[model samples]
Target: MVGLQSTEHAGDNCTPLSDERGSYTTAENGFKEKDATDTHEYDVYGDEDTAEIKYRTMVWWKAAALMLAETVSLGILSIPSAFSSLGMVAGCILVIGLGALATATGYVIGSFKLRYPHVHNMADAGEILAGPIGREVLGAAQVIFIVFLCGSHVLTGLIAFDTITEGASCSVVWAVVTAVVCFICTIPRTLNGISYMSVVSFISILAAIFITMITVGVNGHTGTVTASAHLTFAKGFLAVTDIIFAYAGHVAFFTFIAEMKKPEDFPKTLYTLQICDTTLYLIVGIVVYAFVGDTAVAPALGNTGQLVRKIAYGIALPTIIIAGVVNGHVCAKLVFVRIFRRNGMKSKHMNSHTFTGWATWIAICLAIWALAFVIAEVIPFFNDLLGVISAVFASWFTYGISGIFWLHLTPRSERWTTTKQKAKTIFWSLVVMMGALIMVAGLYASIVSIIDGYKSGGFPGPFSCVSRAL
Candidate 1:
């Protein structure tokens, strides 16, 4: 395989590569190269000559498919509800604007990774910007972000089971069953292993939502479909946050790029994710909201007739579970890498598929899934959980951090030297501010909504056996 080479243009804009630890550099390609004696440590495929497992093997399309599966997961379920709150004009604008912003930020992430080829996750990128403390802070944040996503999936699974079964079983029992199934599905150790499953995930969600759109369109709507709504501040912002969550997949881009066969092909992968998701979000959100109008519920699957609702949720089962599996793999890999790297045995054990490697990976997956189950039982409400996760984590990881990355990549001296460069500088500056505004305002809205839900008995208490089925 040809190594990833930075285009002359990409190289010109980037600062000369240097490493504090002197263990890696960008001279070999777009990736880092270890010393001669430690050559295998940073080999793109992790000592492929002897190792039983290889990670950097996915082609661009496969990586794009995995990202589509990971990103376009449960988030899509919330878009139509957002439309109901924000109305058609504001909802469509936010969806398109945010999707475009997510694409730009995602591109920034790809550039940052190419410049510092060793950076595999947010934590690594953090290290370059702020040192060990940055590493710890961003690393913890990334894990928390992915974990919340896992929890969201678990919550969706619970809802799916309840919706499908008509509440025949205790909700808690369904939550446990959901977690166990996610645990088993996440046992695959490599992105390459899981990429095939993502195809099924993508197809499953497409079929489920299309069925819903067709059914709802034919049956007609519950209330007026407006271009605008006169909602309160908290209500409106909460709706906007749901749209933000729909494009929150930027958090996983670095990890995806790391595992790609040709990291330089990431532009194709990024565009693939953005286009598919944006088009899908617009169609699904508009169609569902137009049909259900003001009475639309989240996860949107429940808005259909009883039989169709069950069928939609049933068809959506693979995406609900497999998408979670994709994220579960990320968190598990983060922990797995941190452990082995700390002990100076990463390449040997992680790449060789040793007993220690397999044991540690499985244990980590089990532990993370168990935590996800707890979070699902505690939160129990789908929209509120997504709102909080979007506010707290997605705000920074997806938007704010990427802006910082772009600013960091350009040489300060050159930032104002050209018209195009100046425009980029100004745009990225706004992106940073937008992320902060979303975080602060979004947190307030999400909190208020949750409080209101509890006060009005709209939300069941944590771990209550109440069914969240619509």
Candidate 2:
């Protein structure tokens, strides 16, 4: 059996507990102790054995690749559909711009917290800046939002499955298959394998985009560049909200930063990821809009595969299907980890058992899919409502949190210290307040859309119109 030792060198401030004594010992008996200059050793796993905890830094490119994989998934497929429903020209510009601004703001806030590296995660940073209440609020909000986002991904996967396997099998069966595949791909013991999977997903998605562009180019199609008579500013902004909702994974990027070896590298990685994501979204949006046109884009490709298959038959469909599965897996694992930790379960330990852990994950995935299926069948306009809610939260998380962090972190004396800093503070604060007001308006608009959908006898046309108007 091997033993481990911890040496307390100069400047070490940790206090020794009563259980830590003068000699090396097995943990099953009690924790060992060490003096200022002596090394203390312990048995690994309460046995007379020792093991090393290995740590490695992530390369900049790996971080960028992970972020790229996450950004491209369902967001790319949803953007063009949103543009068609909301009005292409207006939706594309506003949504893409606002989403980028919000994301960049979040990166700034994260960078500010990283200046004091002792804080481990966003929740810890919130606590340092604002106290216990801030920690609880931020932690609870993050966990809940992650869960909802995971549920949203499950719903998206089911929708994709239904689209691909239309008329051949039941939607529920397809949903189960997709969920199981996602669970297997996720819930692993380590994050090392995800990089390769992410690369594959990225490649597959790019191929689909290539097919889409070729199809549009060969057809000599150039999409409508202006809004129609029916399109108004109100509809334009609402459509913008929808497009932002599809790209609202900015906050989630912080989770990766927390685990990164060099937290300071996050800003560069985040900026690069967002730039890549925006470029991809713009190119895909142009191609999809050109190929299908506004009149056909809205209702024709209800699923991602339908759109891909329409452009290219052999490879595009399967490529998109695999990409959807990868996205669903990543989202599920993220949500599960957050929820489990919030409930006081050690996710690392729980996730080690493949059978039990995966079974629990599968159950959660099914429940989310079931709820989505019911909403899709009964409400039909549920997607629009989801889009609005997601946008509201995304806006609050980006603008509100960024403003709060900046306000709280700056010293009171520095409030009026510099003209540029003062201007920045005011600008951020106003952005936060405006985001809050917009969220309120979005909620009201969502309610109105739902009512209109009910009155229209299950038709989502009125909701789409209202969504565009907002």
Name the best candidate (by lDDT): 1
What TM-score does each of the candidates earn?
0.90, 0.71
Question: What tens digits encode model 1's per-residue C-alpha lDDT throughout 1-470?
Answer: 01122212222222212222323443311223434332212322333545578788899999998999998888788888889999999989999999998998998898888666667788877877887788889999999888888988888898899989989888888889989999998998889999999999999999999999999999987767999999999999999888888888888888888788898999999999999999999998899999899888888887899999999999999999999999999899888777655311234566766787799899999999999989878764655766776898899998999888877776677677768778888988999999899999998998898888878887676787878687
In angstroms, give how far residue 77 of model 1 lies from its true place.
0.8
Candidate models: Cα lDDT each: 0.82, 0.52
Q: Poorest 10 consecutive residues of model 2 by lDDT?
A: 42-51
Task: Compose the digit string of candidate 2's lDDT tens values, residues 89-205.
Answer: 655676677667766576666655443333334454566566777666765665455445544554454545555444355554544554455555554333345556667667766
C-alpha lDDT (0 to 100) for residue 49 of candidate 1: 49
Worst 10 residues of 1 by lDDT: 1-10
Residue 57 displacement in candidate 1 (angstroms)? 1.1
